[model samples]
Target: MEMAWFVIVTVMLAMYVVLDGFDFGVGMVYPFVAHTEADRQTVRASIGPVWNANEVWLIAAGGVLFFAYPKAYAAGFSGFYLALILVLWLLIFRGLALELREQVDHVLWRQAWDTAFTTSSVLLAVVFGTALGNLIRGVPLNRDGYFFVPLWTDFQPGAAPGILDWFTMLLGLSCTVILAFHGANYLVMKTEGLLYQRTVSAARILGWMSAGYTVLTVIAVPLVQPSLALNFSRNPVVYLAPLIGVIALGYSLYFRIRGRDTSAFLASSVFIFLMLVSVMFGMYPNILVSTTDQALSLTVYNAATDSYGLTAGISWFVGGFLLILTYQIYLYSQFWGKTRADDAH
Candidate 1:
């Protein structure tokens, strides 16, 4: 049951990344993509219908984690209290920026809100990417399963790890650029006329940025997680994820250049999926690892609830997921195709 719930939660988290990720990416690129008031409105209209819906996956993932892996949820939330608060603040401000940006007609008012949205979006993406890096790099979980990391300690990858380190920051940057390109591609695909042309140019620029940063991240991963390299050496199949990611990225570039919007966006989603799978596969059974002590590793089995509880949880989880899947399908079907300006408020 614990294993089932873990899989469910992981899938939910991945869904959030693939869905809400582009929205966050859109927010990050908003200021630059939308040069004028009309352009900004088009950008907002492109993401407005889907932004709030995308977040539902995150909420669902958290619910499952809290219910199924209560211990891990408690430990993780408590240990990462500061980071979580920042994430919450980013979400709040990002939402406010979206809702209140056009409420007033003044130049200063619009500019302030746009800046807030962009800054918060960038920060949110970095925090999320850093959080993922910490997961792969492992935390300083002691015997009590509690640890706190400040912004920086030594500014090195593994040397006295902190919330922001060389490795994690690079990963965060990669996430930022990748999402920026993804959002750009999305805007290009959805919007027409001048908005589409701007999106195409932005996509090209951010696409190059994404490609360069992704390469750096790929190189850094094995260097930062030497054990992962060792694991890949032992099991050559693990290399497939990165290989597939490279291929998908190439496809994205080709499709974007060819002006094939849907295919380009699809490739973007695939790239994110392959990259996430690569990280998860590298980390394997360990839910959390200790930077300070190797013995304090948190594995799925070790961190799970007991046998009977897990068994019952599995049944409930499966049922819930089927319903969730049905609803999601219906929702997407209802909102299929490109959103028009008339459709948006």
Candidate 2:
């Protein structure tokens, strides 16, 4: 039951990344891809209908985590309190920027909100990426199962690690680039005219950047923290995660070069999905590792609720999941196809 709930929670988190990730990518690269008001509107239009919906997955993931693993949720939330607050602020501002930007007529007003939107988006991406890095690298969980992390300690990995560090920052940067590429690919599929060509160019450039950064990060992970390599080394088949990622990346690039929008976007999504799943695999049996001691590791078994709670939660979750899934399908179907001026309003 614990394993089942863990898998369900992990899947929910992955769904959040795959769904909100592209929209976050769009915001991160919006300023770069959009030169004029019209360009900005089109970029906004492309994600407008589904951006809010994409965000719900994150909330759902968090809620499920709280329900399924209350202890783990308490530890993680309290330990990363400062970081979580920053993410909250960024999300709020990003949403406000989207809604308030067009509410005013003044050019300065629009520019201010646009700048706010892009800034919040980039920061959100970096912060979220760094959070993932910390998870992979492990946290300084004390015997009490909770510990606070500063923004930086020694600016290095494996030390009394902080919220930001060289290795973690690299992950953040890689995440930024990867999402930018994803967003650009999405734009290619949903846009037309000169903007389409610009997005294609952006996608192509960002794709190569993402590939390079991904390779570098993968190489550095083991060097920084050897524990992440334990599972893969013990079982060679685990290598398929990275292998599939590389193949997906190649397909993304190939399709992009061939001017295949939908395929390229799908490939990009697959690449991200594989990479995240690899992380999940690497850190298996251990949801949150204690940098201070291996004995303190939070695994699916240790961090979960009692079987009775889990059983009840799982049944309720299944019903809610199906309803949400049905709504999502209907929503996407209603908004399917290229976004244009009509979606901007």
Candidate 3:
């Protein structure tokens, strides 16, 4: 039962990443993709209908963590307090920007909100990515089950590293570039004219950045987590994720050259999915690993709720999934097709 809930939580988080990650990517590249007022509107319209709904999965995942795995929820949330607050602020500002941008008629008012939206989205991606890096790279979890991370330590991957270490920072930057590429691809698919061309250029730039940085990060991972080397060495098929990612990168280049926006955007999504899965696979079982102490590693089995709780959670999760699935299908179906000038929320 615990294992089942573990799988459910992982699947939920993965679903959220694949779904909301693209929309967040769109917002991250908003300023670059849409230079003019009309262009901004088109970019906004492209993701307007889906953005809020995209967030529901995150909420559901969090709810599951809080209820099913309360220990992890408390430890992770408290340990990463600063990051959680920053993420919340970003989400709040992004939400306001989405709602208020259209409500105001003044150019300055709309532009201010648009800037906030884009900036928040960009920062959110970086923060989220760094959080993942911190998890994979492991934190300084003590016997008390709580840890703190300052901005930085020595730029190495060894014991008791800081939050903004070179590795984490690079992870954040990699996330930002990848999402920016993802967003640009989305814009290329959803909007046309000057905005499309601009987004295409932006996608090309971000694509290269993401590819290069992701490669560097992948190479650095085994160094960061010596235990993960076995997953690659013992099970060669695990390498397929990165292989698919490279293929996706190639598709991004090809689609950009051929002006195939939808294909490019879809390929970018695949890239994010493969990368995320690779990371999760690398850190299997261990939800939190302490770099300073091998004995302090927190595996999913150790962090899970009791047997009765897991059984109850699974039942509830099934009902919730059906409800969420129904609404999501309706939402996407309603918003399908290329966004138009006349489309308004």
Assess candidate 1 and give its lDDT.
Answer: 0.81
lDDT of 2 at 229: 93
Best by lDDT: 2
In order, candidate lDDTs are 0.81, 0.87, 0.81
Model 1: per-residue Cα lDDT at residue 119: 93
lDDT of 3 by residue, 54-127 (tens): 89999998998877777778789988998899999999998999888888799899879988988888888899
After TM-score superposition, the amount by which residue 225's alpha carbon in candidate 3 deviates from its true location, in angstroms, is 1.1
Per-candidate clashes come to 0, 0, 0
Looking at candidate 2, what is the lDDT of residue 178?
94
- Candidate 3: global Cα-lDDT? 0.81
lDDT of 3 at 245: 74
lDDT of 2 by residue, 144-229 (tens): 88878888999887647988888899999998999889888888888888888888999999999998998899898888768779
User: Could you say which candidate leads in TM-score?
Assistant: 2
Report how far off residue 333 is in candidate 3 (Å). Answer: 2.1
Worst 10 residues of 2 by lDDT: 336-345
The pairs that clash in candidate 3 are none
Candidate RMSDs in order? 1.9, 1.2, 1.8
- Among all windows of 10 consecutive residues in model 1, the one with the lowest summed lDDT is 336-345
What's model 3's TM-score?
0.94
